[model samples]
Target: MKGGKIGESGGLTFWLASPGDYDDVMAISDGIYEGNDYLPHRYHSWMTEPYRVVILAKRDGKLVGLASGLIVDGGSTVFLEGMRVCSREQGRGFAGVIQRFTDQYIRQLYPNVRMKRLVRGEDPRPEKLAKFSLLAKRAILSLQIEAKAFHAFLSTLRAKLEHETGTGSLEQESRLVVLEEEQLRHILLDPGVSSQIELPGHMIIQDWQPLKLVESNFEVLRRRNLTWLADSLEQPTFLSLHTPPYPIPYKGGSFRFSIDLFGTKADLACRALLAHMEMVRGAPQLFQDPQTGGTCC
Candidate 1:
């Protein structure tokens, strides 16, 4: 679509994103997701992928918002990965303006595609779901494990793995390894193996389903660094380690983990378990007990 003025302000313009828009797009995303590092890398990948569409809104030459969507499920589904307006531009009707514009753009490009977005309970603006014609189909119960419980669970699981393999402890390992999809599946979904260990968190299993794969020019499984993994063909996926209460309050704080698991439940229990281990192994101090003021093992 041709770029043009968006509103009476005349300062806002909407257009399809190009390679040059990466920095501006990321700047807007950083503000919206609270300085997430994962999106920037995936945004670069998306710019080259044929199955993705990125729309950007700029106000008087500065980027103010963006909407990224992927054509998935064999071109029958349009998955809206993210949509956000900069903090300064929010509440001034920019959201609805961008949302309406993006919807029209997608309909023209993929008229038969069913649009969807995985909405989290903690999503800042739940009202935005209506813009994409997305409705609540199901609720996945996400568990928030306490620091102590998570530590204990990782300790037990690590001991079990070491005992079975006759290998040294994984605790000393400070690197993150990108597991092959099959290797991850075996490690996480094998009922006989994981059931042996007493997992600490409250047990809640979301229903599992095979994710629809869409080809991307980027190698989603490849790791750009030791600390993160991306494993999706249709959607931009990321598994990264970061500390909680972000913008890291102090130099040696406890570590936390975050991942983008857009809707498809593929061994979340295993992912969460491993994520805790990742934080412990990679950045132990971040997991320190806030009250007792003790560092993680």
Candidate 2:
């Protein structure tokens, strides 16, 4: 059913997402997360953030597909972080349809964003033991997870996903699932772990730091710094990046991303940040200012 008549199906309509659409999108998303042990819980935040384009395709008014993300790298990178057409609609060629519309819209709205990147992958931990983060397990398991294993897991999974999809989508999926850089620090704050080895059991993570596990090789902080700079300098910029040294909520020994405004155009920087700030300030309750970075992260 490649390139099947999609628009002709008239029942299909693509539009921007509304608050009312969360329930519908979540229904499918939650099912996908639960059905597969490999999937993580990042979308809970992704959906709530602004600058994220939520494009939904409805068939006979029933939601059938969802594409969500934002312009990044100073609108030079339109990251297609998540794109899913219902499994039922897969072969109907609707995925390509949504992709086309999304790509075009980004081009119109944010002319600078470059290529789209998507991610997909599996959990390296055995299904049963996947949740435990070595840092937390030290007190209980008495053995920190081999950070080397973390590196190997990331390298292998990334390579494998790229091989499988023949594109970067798999890598995108992997990033989308786990905690972002700031969220990693936030996760470390959870009071879930306290004192010594007692049992050998499957660990249930309150928040996983999978992204942090990749930062060592990815140079995420440096990349984010460069991205922040680009966004501040570019025209009609759309940018998103995580803040670092993000400590516990109350602890607050500040770690933040700083933009050297030295030669940057202040007007564009301020406007872009302000627009993003306003956009996110309107998000659902599940999202808060801290996690969303209030404007810049």
1-297 in candidate 2: lDDT tens per residue? 011122323347777766656667655554442232111233444545544566777888777887765654344545564577676777888877777777776677777665554433433456524533332231111111222243344456446545765655542331212235454333322333111111112121111211211223134233332222223121212223222312111211111222221112443333333333233233343132343321112
- TM-scores for the candidates: 0.50, 0.38
On TM-score, the candidate that comes out on top is 1
Error of 2 at 269 (Å): 37
Q: Cα lDDT of model 1 overall? A: 0.49
Tens-digit lDDT track for model 1 on 1-297? 223443323356777777777667656665443333345545666777666788888887788888777665556766565678887888899877876777677777888777554444454465665554433343343333445576676677767655754547543433334555544434333443223332212111112111232222112222222233323322222232222222211222332233323323343333534664545444544444573222222
Clash counts for all predictions: 7, 11
Off by over 4 Å in 2: 1-11, 33-50, 122-297
Worst 10 residues of 1 by lDDT: 200-209
lDDT of 2 at 276: 31
Show model 1 residue runs off by greater than 4 Å: 1-11, 121-272, 275-297
For candidate 2, give the lDDT: 0.41
